[model samples]
Target: MGLYDFTFYDLIHRNAVCYDGKPAWFEAETGATTDFSAFKTQVDCLAAGLQKAGIRSGDRIGVVGKNSLAFFTLYGAAAALGAIVVAVNWRLSENEVAFNLDDCTPKMVFADNEFGETITSLRDRLPSVDRFINLTDNGPLDAFDDLLDDAPFSGEPVSANDGLVIIHTAAVAGRPRGALLSHANLLCASLHLNHCFNLSPDDVHLNLLPLFHVAGLFMAVCAFHAGALNINMAKFDADKAVDLIAAHKASLLFDFSPILGSILDAGEKNGADISSLRAVMGLDTPETIERYRKTTGGCFYVMYGQTETSCLTTMGRYDDCPGSAGRAIPLGRVELVDDADNPVPPGQAGEITLQGPMVFKGYWNLDKDNDQTFRNGRHHTGDLGRFDEKGFLWYAGRKPEKELIKPGGENVYPAEVEKVILEHPAVSQTVVFGIPDPKWKEAIKAVCVCAPGQSVTAGELIEFVGQRIARYKKPQYVDFVESLPEKDGAIDREAVKQRYGGKQPGNS
Candidate 1:
């Protein structure tokens, strides 16, 4: 059998039957919890609901909401029944949401009440979506609970290569591309975490990362697969996350570098005891990683992978080597390559390319992207990196087209924000880039050339963008220029960055 031989079908069923009373997932805000026994039934029932709704194998179902127990169940149930779960980033603007919905055109979409009006507003543009279920509460629309009340669905014939999840990527040209992850892709990544971290049922995991991204959905479920309790937060708050970690004595944590500070600050301020954490994973500096180890009494874990590769294709639990993303996992191989896909020497910088079961099948409905990305049977990660003398992989920068802004733990593509900024009548042309911020780690900055004789305030432009896209994608700092520097009749991005990207962004 190949490395991609297994699926979660057997593992989930085994865990459900073996660890029947074991806790599966919990939401700290509502104090809602579900055990494995209930989770099994809930997933089956949801699967039956999808079947009854006329959803067949290979059909796509959309979900747009915050982290919750129901969200995990929705994903699990769809995978069990051979339907692909399309996770919509709730932070996206209506138009951005429409583009994705219009792309995959799921048969039914499940959403929280917070987006009821937004979803209703998008109904006209989503021609393929026939049903909308209220995920949080019973409203005028169909309720999620109603789906669970249906007769349980029997397991389907499944394959490791079957599509299970569609995680959208903004890494390509500012447009959202759905990366179709197969069952093997998800399972391999989850199992890699389990194997490397020694995750077990006794572990309590605080899953604060957003589920719309792989970092949240894929990593948290590893704890679930191990029969561990996975605590979720609807929205991130340092105090709340810390309290939950302390109260539940969470053993594992996944968060961005900036968020870890917030959690530590809240914990320290409130005098909350978060000593139970034994493994905290994400980006952090040498000092911060040391602090995390000292504070949580856990090994600080760091790794690198994109939505296209599920999550962590590589990880290292180092007490010494500080900033490395670590070597590629046993189940995968990472190579630094030049433009023509030829491997560069260990010391030389090149594009990071991955070959493993963790790699997603390909982008949904994008043959060209899939072919290019899956060239030579390996997923080409657009990230630039290199291996140190000791073989530790280090991040460099992104490819020209794939520049990303990770503000407040969300991936913000500059082109996507620029697309919305150009939509404003007052704006003529703009170049968006990220700048280092103390709070968000990296905050967005937009350099603009306004229409002749037309005036626009920075606040107005920010508001204009905030309304049209995810608020995090809105530029934290905006600079209006009389005229933008040009190269080959296009805005010179480097010149724009040098001019406007250095200033510290105040809190927005």
Candidate 2:
């Protein structure tokens, strides 16, 4: 049978029947494990619990915490009964968290012990929350274990297009928008990923990305589709990650370059063998990608997608070709279009848009945004990119962010400049943005985090970039910092602007 015939719950159910005695989840730190049959049973109980609590189809339920097998069970359970699970980023500030809680107005929130204080402080603010099911015994709530006592769901909702998860955007431009992904969207994503990553039942997935993000959720779901073992880390511990890789003989790792570097270090330090890993998925500088490839003795797969696309709409192995985000995956059209919604000629940069089954349903409660995103019957990704003559797409930075740094009529993307600055030996991380300039409408400025116990002056790095790209593209001003401010894991440009480019004396 074709995969499109199945829903996410169907995938889980099949895994229980086909791979029943095999391990489905493993927690390295606690040595906790759940086999396929146990996972299916637990999900059934949780779904019935929600149904018993009067959660009807389309009700929004929130789950805020670090990664855990229980929360994943919630994902399946909620989806089974046609309820939507909103995974909240635990790293968000109280105000940020409140913004999401208010936005979704979830009927219930399953949060962990760490988020107890914030929920208590905002208790008066959250009118929609009926109850808080604390993962531990700390909040003004009942225990999560109580849900299993209620009953077990014998049947699931019959719709495949029903919404299942809402993954919020990072709010890089403004307020975060919750991208609603349905069962069809996820299954389509799994179909593309299962083929793109060469996944199989023999493969084991090592997932470290935050579960609140689409990447994390998609990784686990992809494993379930293959009926493979998934070793999901609650949080990345470089040393423990390496040990897990060696112990599980993991085949695939989906993470960023920095985290991959730490794993390589831990493996080297402990003499752990990671030869079992065949592919590592990430995006970074070409040099960084090659370094990771050599370190793990694995192919480095590069892909591009966001919450709006469910997970990844395009992907390719570096070993297949040097660069390029690759052509569109199955059942998708990856393209570059001008502002007029016209397709751009090959090699000309334009906004990247995806038209496919995997595209998300829409943003939750965001009417105007939904219209803007789905205007042309396509997910209009505000990020810019271009297709080569061979049909391989190359990713550019965000359109809004790229629009910020135009100096002297020539566009200079902060990302382009930041990439050069990161190449400097002393620089560890950096942010480049348009700072107001009297001469040029907006001048390019660089804020950098230097390597451990190492320093480089502003002038030296500016000259270094001046040599590589256009002199005008070089950062006119540079500031060295000990650390770059982060929001939702990525560098927060707004926070950096407030801290470094704040109002001067006598200025608004």
Candidate 3:
């Protein structure tokens, strides 16, 4: 099938038949398993219940839940019914959740029972919602399980072009913005991923990432499309992950760099039977990939993509391409374009722009921001990167705040230096800012919040960064703040910048 011509549920149904008796999905905490036949039945029933509730193809349905089997089922059910599913981050404040629910105007909300307080606070605010269903409860308004008790559903399938999901992004840390992704986007992304990774039905996927984020949901979709077993973890615990790998004999785990680092740390301290672990890949810096591969004895892989790109624009094909975010997946047009919107020569740094079936329609309602981001036909990725001679894309840094300058024209990217500085035992959160310096235009300054009960002097931090990164990139000035102001427990860039670039402050 062509990349963009198939509906979202089609992939799951097809894969189910391909590997019917095999385990399709399982919750690590409960040992509950949903094989192909059961999965299909539940999806149909949920779709029927949703349709019975007056939801139609274009209707938006919001789902706010933790990583559970219900999330996967609801997501598919929404697709089957041709409705758009908005995956709201459970980590956000009640006010934020209320704001998003009001803004999105979903037909109904499937909320996690754990967030009942948030729901209680925002119930009045979400007037547009026709119903509030508890994802876990079996009684009352549209309980996830009861709705899915039917053996099968005859509901009509939505087209591939139908809006599939609206995923909210935690904007550099501000009011989150929703990105509208279509069924075509999701289907193409999974298909492209399956082909690129050469996934087989025998593979097993471990899902620890949050389902609210693209990585978490996309991992499930990829595994489903490939007819692979998907093991869903309620949360990321390194020790639990190791145990699950050994017990389930999991083949591949879609993880981030930090998770791998933690697992590697655990592996070094307490041994693990990773014999069944075929691959370990996630979003990480190129340098971290090398270090991780060396430490794990070449057992990990690296993937590179953005949330705007449906999370699978590029990947470093396991074992084939060692360090590069592999060549563009089929049906994607990835370009390294200069500031002038002209394509740059190979190996030259430029903004990465992608045109693909998987690219999101646009940022929800932020037309000005959308125009700024999605210029012409391509989605401008704000990331600075380049394509190498072998067609591998190399990520450099973000276009905005790309460089951290020091007193002597020294330039550093926070992503690169932060990776190294984050290794320090005393640091919990560290942000490097370019403080104004009259002598050199700008000087590198570090604002750090230390780990609980751990302390380090300014001189010690400066030396720590210097030993890891270039000496010039090390902060000339260090400010040990009590705690960084966070919007919702996540780093707030604007707040950080305001804190560093204080009022009435200029060039140093």
Best by lDDT: 1
Q: Give the worst 10-residue stretch by lDDT in candidate 2.
A: 402-411
- Candidate 3 lDDT tens digits, 247-287: 88777777654576666666666777656766766654445
Predicted candidate 2 versus true structure: per-residue lDDT over 428-508, tens digit per residue: 998877765543445677889899978888899999888765576688778888788999999888788778773333322
Please provide TM-scores, in order, for all candidate models, with all chains considered together: 0.94, 0.79, 0.76
For model 1, what is the C-alpha lDDT against the true structure? 0.82
Comparing 1 and 3 on lDDT, the stronger one: 1
Error of 2 at 318 (Å): 1.0
Model 3 segments more than 4 A misplaced: 1-5, 138-142, 149-152, 285-299, 318-323, 401-508
| Least well predicted 10-residue stretch by lDDT in candidate 1 | 1-10
lDDT scores in order: 0.82, 0.78, 0.74
Candidate 3 lDDT for residue 5: 59
Q: List the residue pairs that clash in candidate 2.
A: none
Residue range 433-472, candidate 1, lDDT tens digits: 9887766677899988889878899999999989877787
Ranked candidates, highest TM-score first = 1, 2, 3
Q: Please report the TM-score between candidate 2 and the true structure.
A: 0.79
